[model samples]
Target: MSTFQRFRESWLRPILFFGNNLLSLIGGALTSASAFVLIGFYLVDAFGHGGSRNPYLGIILGFFLPALFLLGLLLIPLGILARHAALRRAGKIPSVYPRINLADPLFRHGIEVVLLATFVNFVLLGTATYRGVAYMDTKDFCGATCHVMAPEGTAYPVFAHSGVPCVGCHVGSGVGGYIHAKVNGTRQLIDVLRNRYPAPILTNDLLPSASQTCLNCHRADAWIGDKIRISTTFDDDEKNTRTRSLILLHVGGRDLTGKLSGIHGAHLGHIVYISTDTRHQIIHYVAKTEADGSVVEYTDTNLKQARVGVQRAMDCTDCHNRVAHSFDTPEKAVDRSMLAGAISPELPFIHKESIALLKASYGSPEQARTQIAASLKRFYQSNYPDLWQKDQPRIAEAASRLAVLWSQNVFPFMKVTWGTYPNNLGHNDYPGCSRCHDGSHNSASGQSISSDCSVCHNVLTIDDSNRSQLADLGVQ
Candidate 1:
């Protein structure tokens, strides 16, 4: 007989003896079942024309099933060891395992079955593992699949960076990153199962650095000159008096002439700061690195002594923190709707009414929706009966729009209310640009960080009804 034949014949009897036990038999059955289920899921995902977009289904196929498959794999070896131990304890093990008769049809059939099963197990394991990891990296898995992420999930589709995947920001781009994400995900899963996760999840420290994620698409050296911004708002009066503001934003960056010019150019890689709070709104120190490698440090004069906080280099996310999941303030949300004609500005006190309803507290979104719509209708019915009857359709439209706006901005279940997350792009509603540019931070030689209005933006018009300048500039 050949060497392979001799080895197989010598080992086959013991393999059969050990694997015939109940534990090993059960392990084999479990392994076979899990493998088949995984194969079925893969086939459906591959051929079902977009498959099932259901998030829960993905959890099963992506995470739970794969875990089951791995457990089954582990049990196979454990069962073999248990069987070996049991036989030795019983003193049933012979001095040498019996040699098999290769010529016997039963032994030959058993060997053929084992070889085929092993080959199938290897193939399925590889395919299942690859698909499971790929599924976990999907946007749905990160957002819709997790209850704690509902607030972000609701806000993501409305923002500028909706096209990008969550992993683009949360996970790094290599084998190491993949491993880290999976390990973190496992811990998160455990927390979720135990109902121990924090509401309104904070991810400031959890995110990968901007260099690994954001810089992949937006280069810091790219040039972008000044840009104009026009904003409109309505007063709380009966007429809902409209006013507009025109501002020129100095969104400077590196220019084609190879000179760093604007806001992005000034801060992208040249600044470091200390934030004394989790939100990074309370900046206590600022340092600018000069072109000549000289560093000038500025300490916040308001702070009695230099307090320790998170010290880090400034990056895109420092300013554009809400680019992907931005929740608008009540005023901004109402203004956008009225501007879009979803909420009629023709209705008296509509802006004021909308703001009042948006700011009110409620136990849940459904309750908020019902209460807001009923409250608006009641206000019109009680105060302006004639107008209520005449413009009922407009009132209904406004109520529906406000209810949606409220739901979009507030998540009572997650404890995410108005301004739960601060946008650091500007200083209007939050301490954004003013955190470092308030002229309070002074260098040792008495140089202060400039708070001058003209440094960042120039306000051409403030709360004016006139659009003549915007018209003249062809931006109206």
Candidate 2:
């Protein structure tokens, strides 16, 4: 007889006897199906370049299929056990269990098949695990899947560091960091499933140090001496008079003479501070380590208690917190749009109308878009019929641009309206530099943190002539 026939009659028949019950048979089918599906997914992912392009498809193949495969694996053994117990209770237990004889070729062939199957399973499991982790690391997996992160996710794509992976800043490098990030992600997933996630979710407190993430791209001592910034504003008048402000920003770093200079250099030394609030907007104390290792402590005189909050070392993100996900104020947005000629300055009271339209409340984004455009058209058509007749298209275009600004910055669903998250870069809008530099923080020796106007920037002219200094510099 053939070795296969011998095996089927002897070893295989005995082994199959236990799994002949309905539950075991069902489990066998499920296991077979799941294994085949998993293998198919792996093959397609391996050869299909980047696998499924859709985020939902990636979630299914990466997470759901593997879970089903595991479920099937567990059910197989459980079904076999239950069947054996039922047979035993009915007094149908076998007189002898299946015997193994290594001397027989049938036993040897069956052993070989089991070993090969095990190896294949290991390969599949390893690949699936690797691919699953890789998929989770992607930006789409992080931002697109989570509803609570909508505000940041929407702003991220249009920002400066859009190309950088979310994990690149959020997670530390190496295996430990990867495992930590996964554990945190799993906790977040649980929160999302339970609908317990907070609206306008706060920034994570346990972020990796800026040295490990930010310094990889930005140099600490790189010099960028002085930068001239021109800001234009239109007055709320019949003529919509334009005025420009030219400021020379001291954005310097370390010079060739090894002297630290400018804004960057002043902040490059070892420094620490205490923030009373979660968002770090209220600075209570500041301490700077001098060159000789002397620490100068500067406590806010306005604060009653000196050490009442979270103490943290100073870093690049302390000021540039919203670099990757900045939401502009309505005034800033209008200024940029007008400067780009997206909203015509020639249109009467376009600045005032745009700001009012943007700041007004609406139930939804669609409503905001519709009402903003309609309101602008109505105002122009009623107040300035002559201008409206000549600049109908201009009014429509300006309204559309305003609508876009509102959509980009405001999300009613997430309760993320204007100024929900403050940018700490400037002192005008938020308590940015003034948090510590408002002439309030003083040392024991009566010296206070300088809040001089010229410390960071020198204003060349405020509300100067209509002619731009940029045009004079041949940079129109």
lDDT of 1 by residue, 338-404 (tens): 9999999999999999999999998887898899989999999999999999999999999989889
Clashing pairs in 1: 252-262, 253-262
lDDT of 2: 0.81
- Model 1: CA > 4 A from native: 49-51, 89-91, 98-107, 474-476
Q: Residue by residue across 407-456, what tens digits does model 2's lDDT show?
A: 88888777898998999888887899999899989999989989998989
TM-score of each: 0.95, 0.85
Error of 2 at 20 (Å): 7.2
Highest-TM-score candidate: 1
